[model samples]
Target: MSRIEARIEDLGLALPAPMLPPGNFKLVNVYGGLAYISGHPAIDGSTVLVQGVVGRDLTVEEGYEAARLAALSIIASLKHELGDLDRVTSWLRAVGYVQSAPEFHDNAKVVNGFSDLIIEIWGEAGRHARSAPGQGPSPLDVPVIIDAIVAISE
Candidate 1:
């Protein structure tokens, strides 16, 4: 196995089967030595793992898990595009959008789910600039959606 996939196995994690982009947009675009991943919702096939706004139908913790699931899908997308996760040299940036209730304010904490898994698998290489912003709703009404950019071997 490639180093990253082996690390994922060591972490007791598995990448979900990759889902195609719902629209015409490309799932990832590699250019200038960076791979741009599109936003991914917390989905396994057609099933939405968790939906509804945080602080309403879901707790902060649930939102975190949702973000983590979405991150798995993001990793799947990376694998689909790059063929080998080891090609990823560094995580450059990420924007995690949390579907949240009006009173919710822990967007960053929720987004930590996505970052946590990345760091777990890639160690310091996964560290990156991030934005965890609150949103009223997200595509497919998922509790969280995350998009990323990573430096990769060409």
Candidate 2:
């Protein structure tokens, strides 16, 4: 197993299968040592795992779990595309969209779920630049939708 996969095991978390995009876009595109992953929600295949607006239908902690679910799937997609998690040299960037109530603005906290998961598995390699979580209606009404850019080796 790859080193990162081993860390995942130690963390007692298993990555879900690579998630399929809800639309026609590619899940990930790789070129010049970078992989661009499309937006991934907390879903399994076509099933929505978490939906609703943060601080309204769901609490901040709930939103965090939703983002973690998306992050798990993101790692799965990276494994599927690159054939090994160890191929990732660094996580470049991530953008997360959070669906929130009009009065709730803790967007960054919500996206930390996704960021924290990656860091848990890959440590420093998972560190990356992330935009302040964007808030608005998401494509599937999921609490969180996240995409990432990763630097990888051949």
Report the number of the highest-lDDT candidate: 1
- Which residue ranges in model 2 land beyond 4 Å of their true spot? none
Residue pairs of candidate 2 with colliding backbone atoms: none
lDDT of 2 at 133: 63
Weakest lDDT window of 10 consecutive positions for candidate 2: 131-140
TM per candidate comes to 0.97, 0.95
Q: lDDT tens digits, residues 31-95, model 2?
A: 89899999888877667889999989998899999999999888888888889889999999999
Q: How would you encode candidate 1's per-residue C-alpha lDDT over 21-138 as one tens digit per residue?
A: 7889988999999999988888775667787888899998998898889988989888988899999999999999888999999999999999998998899999999999898767
Off by over 4 Å in 1: none
C-alpha RMSD of each candidate structure in angstroms: 0.9, 1.2
Native-vs-model 1 lDDT?
0.89
